[model samples]
Target: MTIRIRTALLGAALAGTAATSAVAEEWRLNNFLPETRPETAQIEQFAEDVNAALADKDFKLTVYSGGSLGLKNTDLLRVLPRGAVEMSLMWSNYLGRDAPALSSVFVQGAISTVDELKAVLPVAQEIYEEEYTDWGVTTVGFVAIPTLSVSVFCRDEPIHTLEDLKGVKLRVWAREQVETFTKLGVAAQIIPQEETYVALKTGVVDCALYPALYASTISLQEVTKYASFLYPMASAPYTLGVATDKWESTDPEIRTAITTAADALWERTNQYDKDAEAEMAAREKLGEMGVTWGEDFPEADRAQFMEAVSETWQMLAEEAGGNAMDYRARVLEALGR
Candidate 1:
């Protein structure tokens, strides 16, 4: 009888220890960008910081870069809410189909200068937080992509102005871009990043609007001969979104550690002026690879482009419905435009 009682007590203790060990399992973070990009390293560093911060809990977050998890950026809104993936790096521009209002809050090229971006970011973050909560996910942190110059990369033509764009078939990533270009009398089509190279190679698109920072990621230098700077692209931050339930279930101390580490990342990326320097370096590297650089789009034409894009912004807000126009109004007012 004594031996049996001792065995039962030992089994109970072992089961409790196993349950506690199971609580320290790894969390997965899905990053859509290729490992070559600087942002990927920044994210990996964030994970390391987070792990260090929560060392006592033995928590780990393994980052899967380049979409190795077989998930699409466009599907994050649907998958994230259901906890299909514990966490993901989300871009609002790609989530428009599911969260139109959130998507219309801001667009690339909406703001030109670092001052302008800083002025309007607070408003943007507020709206994003509210909308993401409503969508059944929450942002633990945001990593701002450097404000690189947006440019036209053409396979066989030199495109330097809106007039130049009108004659060539252009590839764009978002509906807002297509509409904005269309409003300026340029014909553009939506093309996914993975498919953009094939599109450019096969005469499907004569030019593509891509940022200077990551042109080499898609081997644009191999396909495009002429590149012309259009405008500084001030994209919204990439969100580190976790399922709402998952976040809520996390221990409060661990949550604090995660957020504290994330806040550090935001400060490092958002409050700095590394964008122009980084963009210049990337462009020089692209030039070294034989991409012919064209003159920057003229200032007179840039004004016209901004005007057309402003109108498109209004149209996008109206189409998105439900406080989207309100959000746009808030952003415009913040920009003091």
Candidate 2:
């Protein structure tokens, strides 16, 4: 409607074209997130660097944001392999059915810190290469993401422990989430991202398991308050992958440029992403928004949750079949387990 809005839209449109155009080795990327957010912005910047690296070469990269390319969070793996999209920045957990092996990275209490987590990606990605290469994709690298601290934003009291979880209705994504919480006696509504805010406002769901950064991004500061640091559940991580066949088809210079740039970007962001200092700032901001963090759930409840969630790890491992053992073994070995 206004000039500023029109200009912003134009910029986004051009951003999408970065993946579509060029008279050479063309690759298209689709992201199901708004570029305004930190994660999405970083993705676009990666695209820019990739484009610059390919400038002299006959190769090109384009990025489509907000799912304009018709790929959902769960569709990238299938779409990428079938030649529908060449690359995507997706949460590998959302690719569960396509490659359930990925759940190991994000499952509750899988690994406690970023260093231990980053150590696992290289090997785990190899174990699941069949899942991606079968679809013509390969993992480039993973981001050291902020831990997925499951939040309980309610019009009710604070939920800080395992006992506090009973009878509570929470929101989740994967089927494993349903089983995990159900075992904890939590009723889960597997809802999409867009529906979560409304779900909270309507009283349809009272609890949500997401990262602290998301609370600020989605303006949850407006409604809910009091996030419990579900210790083991606090961290969640994911990777960025590209179509293997398509990637191989690119000019050598272009490929090297893209990978080198991505590596540097990942290495820098990985540490900064998991810095413990960020949490204190996040808590303070949320508090400023009128939400009070409470010690409603006690340490005993935390111990109970840790014990209960180990079963989920086993369930997830079972879901992955043989892939789990190899993936877990390598990560443990890397961590000196």
Candidate 3:
């Protein structure tokens, strides 16, 4: 070929390369947990897996951990529907304002173990699908963080029975938790996670209803003397969601690649929670630091606790109205309650 023909072919090749680069898709995934947490690492791995799956396709995913993007966990669900962010690993219960049914999973006594959660997840996902569809978001998948039982950690007292919790000021996260504690005669204060450690230390709250792993994560063991496993209050169900329109418009193959990666991440994270090595080690460390763990509640007290929780569930369902009552019924059936 002549020099002119060769130059023309080189120009076309460069133009194609630029076009490919220009069409490359970049997605942002936000997580509120610090990078040190296992869940955050799992989110990063998900990004890596998706990028690897689409390596040739020029799709890139960037993960922002520890709320570095400045979006609070509660804000994720609201902003996602508006397309302000591409993706997020959000706490399902935090979406109670928009979708109260989603909070059913976090209801006290609703789900007690990982196996129970797995059983209820399908129905929960169905409920979530309808809710997200209405909100203009799509759920990628449900991830079960290790079944961290929300236990009570007190500075000077251990909550052994229903009587122990009465009249005590306890810090809580969700409205369901607040309602449950309030019915038990406990003064429940809604406090953000970031402020919990100080609240416990400074006597802002006498006790806190939070996960054992999280207590370990924030070093709550140092300030609190006793950890009560009286009630398996709630389990953390982390959800990954994306903008619905973005998902619908994406290439089907890329969506498949991302979803496949998400499924694997879910399994890995679930197994990590099941193994409970980290939680065990954390408890051990807390013990060394003089934190005492309370024995399980006596059978009678346990029964009474569940009865109250059941009542709270009914009240919540009634308050939510409409599909919420149906959703709560489905969750209870799945849990075999």
Candidate 4:
């Protein structure tokens, strides 16, 4: 009897172990940027926070940065719903093809500053959640980077005026950017961010519209000699999303923990944006790398550029239609425009 009782206890212990192992969940997060970028760092911090919060739960998050998983930025939304990826950090511009509404924040001349974008963030989140839900995903957080403004990084020459942009083969990402640049007589070329350095180095594109910080991140300063601070293009915001079914299956406590972590990430990102020393250090680093910074466009020139890009905004609003159109209206109203 003693021997039989001992064997039964051992069998029960093995079953419990197997059940616990089966219940454990591993989530994969895909980030397109290199580990050095602030965005990547923010996501990494988020993962750590989640892990710590859920220490008692059978949940673990693994982050794959620098596109190590071989998934492009554009592939994130498509794959996340299909279960190919559990989570992703994606840019709004990349989703413009299928969901133009999500990209409304990036409409040229529509949102001029980070503050204006923040003003509409609540509505933007709602809109994004609706769209993400439709596509079988759940949005957890938003990552916004603060910069002086989106600028033109040129290889051979500085684009100081509208005339200088004429006939320039500028690399563009979204359709709206293409329209905006085309109005200024620029030959816009849509290319992947990963391919930008080589394109700029090989003269495939004379200039590209990117954030000022990219000079250090992608070594754009090496290939591009001049950075032109142009019209105040809206910052391209990044979204954190998880597969809908996975999110639904998660325990309520675990979901709350993830939400709490996401809120902390938002606060951290906002503080990072407000840190002037960090911005200056990045700019100084770019200067040390031999990249010349052009003056901000003259007030009159800036006004003219804004006016020219207004048409692109109108086109995007019309193309977006439905919920996207409503979202843009909310954002514009919030901007007091």
Top candidate (lDDT) = 1
Determine which window of 10 residues in candidate 3 has minimal summed lDDT: 270-279
Q: What does the lDDT read for residue 146 in candidate 4?
A: 63
Model 2, 1-35: lDDT tens digits are 99999999999999889856644766777777665
Question: What's the lDDT for residue 17 in model 3?
Answer: 91
Which parts of model 2 are misplaced by more than 4 Å? 1-26, 57-60, 118-121, 128-131, 232-237, 272-274
What TM-score number comes out for model 3? 0.85
lDDT tens readout by residue for model 3, 1-337: 9999999999999999999878867888888877777777778888999999998886788998877888876776678878877888877677778777666545756666677877877777787777777778888976666766557788988876767778578888888777876777878988877788899989999998776766766778777999877655335467789999989998998999889999998788765354457557766777888889887667787777677777887887888786778888888788887
**What is model 4's C-alpha RMSD?**
4.1
* Model 4 Cα lDDT, one tens digit per residue, 63-128: 998888898776667888888888888777788777777766556556666677677667667777
Residue 44 C-alpha lDDT in model 4: 89
lDDT of 1: 0.88
Question: In every candidate, how many clashes are there?
Answer: 0, 12, 0, 0
Evaluate residue 76 in candidate 3 and report its C-alpha lDDT on the 0 to 100 scale.
67
Candidate 4, run of 10 with poorest lDDT: 271-280
TM-score of candidate 1 to 2 decimals? 0.91
